[model samples]
Target: EDQVTQSPEALRLQEGESSSLNCSYTVSGLRGLFWYRQDPGKGPEFLFTLYSAGEEKEKERLKATLTKKESFLHITAPKPEDSATYLCAVQAIGSSNTGKLIFGQGTTLQVKP
Candidate 1:
């Protein structure tokens, strides 16, 4: 069975603190690894797409990387505005791209000013 799980259901960080969130996945075939940031009451915003191990993508203070078995989202110098839920998803090659995503519950981050 294909599945994804994220650690630390919630995180509290002081402004300027840096931390890393963990994402563990198991799938029959990894077609793509996706990372998204979701704010309250809104759909997830795409952040990165990693295809192979040792691959990474970054924007602003956020970085995402994928490996053979897992992925990670690292936040550097987080700010209050950065507070949001981080989600990780995977797409399998057998799927029909019908917008079905196996999502982790999400890691809620809170940065205090």
Candidate 2:
């Protein structure tokens, strides 16, 4: 089975603080890794896509990197507005015809001003 697990279910950061969260995954065959940011009561917004080991993507103060067995999301100098849930999902080979994603429970980040 393909599965994703995120650590530190929640985090609290002071404004301008930087940190990195982890996502561990197990799958029969890895196809893709996805990162998303979701605000309260809203749907997830796509952030990055990592297809292979050593691949990395960045947006604003966020950077996402992928490895064979895990992925990491790093936040730099975050602001209060950056508070949101960071989600990591994976697409596994032979899991879907349409390349659907299975998501982790998510890491909720709270940035204090």
Q: Highest TM-score, which number? A: 2
Identify the candidate with maximal lDDT. Answer: 2
Write down the lDDT of every candidate, Cα atoms only: 0.91, 0.92
lDDT of 1 by residue, 1-113 (tens): 88999998999999999999999999878888899999999999999988888999999999998889999999999989999999999887675655467888899999999
lDDT of model 1, residue 41: 98
lDDT of 2 by residue, 1-113 (tens): 77899998999999998999999999888889999899989999999999999998998999999889999999999999999999999988882536989999999999999
Q: After superposition, how far is residue 15 of candidate 2 from its true place, in Å?
A: 0.9
Q: What TM-score does prediction 1 earn? A: 0.93
Lowest summed lDDT over 10 consecutive residues: which window, candidate 1? 92-101
TM-scores, in order shown?
0.93, 0.95
Counted clashes in each candidate structure: 0, 0
- Model 1 lDDT on a 0 to 1 scale: 0.91
Which run of 10 residues does model 2 get worst, by summed lDDT? 91-100
